[model samples]
Target: MPSDTEQRTRAAVPADAVTEPLTDIIDPDNFTPRLLALLSNALVWRESHELRRRFGLGTNDWRIISSLAIRPGASATEVSDFIGLNKAVISKGVVKLVDRGLVLLVDGPRGSRPMYLTPAGAEMHDAMLPISMRGQEIILADLSADDIDRLNALLRRMLEKTRELHVLENGSDVGADD
Candidate 1:
């Protein structure tokens, strides 16, 4: 009961052949979607470390705070949408920020309410921006200016294509299903 990858490996090489590094066999010239994903995750991890050290924040909390800074006075739902976080997680983040005096909930239209960054939250966000920028600069330093621009464009196209494929296969629209 060989797996698909194992079956392919067996078919490709003789039984007596020595195994080579998977990376070597795989053509690096052919751009893999996985390389884009690995790069994205590495950047995220680097950014998360900076946030943890400077702001004592986790990835979830950093996203919440960053979204609020980008668009001040967003409701829980709005923040959730902006940061691509679940409603429950956003609720918890808001509560935690409120307890720490970093955010405040204000009244909204028709009995609805929204959350806004407090003075403390604004100050923390401003302080964090430079640290986050440094992380970005370090991670992207390996790439030349042209490579950075090309990579950004290619990544955007890949993301869009993935979204389209998901929609085509699942017959469901993105975000609307959730």
Candidate 2:
């Protein structure tokens, strides 16, 4: 009892249709939420990488620097955990940043050590702030404040749920939150 157009549309679909490996499930035809998320992450990463290159720093170094900016005098272990990088990588990054006079190492109790941004590093952070804000604006300008807040909440929940799923799947901690 369907119309001719409906019959044609149904005929166009294969009964045993298989999905392509390279094609995105969410973006089978056009932009989807998952595709948008991936694109957003890629764009942000690109911008951050560009900023790091301008500052004579690597992405990892910039990440550590930014992390310390959030909470100065955090230990290397804390930095590593926050940045989601291994200790060896964080150690090398901290050494490089220290060598460049951008960060200071403070001795803590029981032989513990922590890092804080120096004046020069603070200046760099200030310089990077505008660029980061601009990038964020461009990425989220079309959305309303409420939309952005909802999207951010959803993304955070997704991250937490994904971590839980990962733990269940592998029976090991993801340690995503540092």
Best by TM-score: 2
lDDT of 1 by residue, 1-178 (tens): 9999998978999877877755546555566766766776877788788788877776677678788888887888787766656778888888888898988888989876677788998887787777668767976789999999998898789767866887898885444334
Pick by lDDT: which candidate is best?
A: 2
lDDT of 2 at 161: 89
- Mind sharing the TM-score for model 2? 0.71
Which segments of model 1 are wrong by more than 4 Å? 1-31, 170-178
Residue 88's lDDT within candidate 2 is 81
Clashing pairs in 1: none
Measured with C-alpha atoms, the lDDT of residue 62 in candidate 1 is 68
Per-model TM-score on C-alpha atoms: 0.68, 0.71
Clashes of each: 0, 0
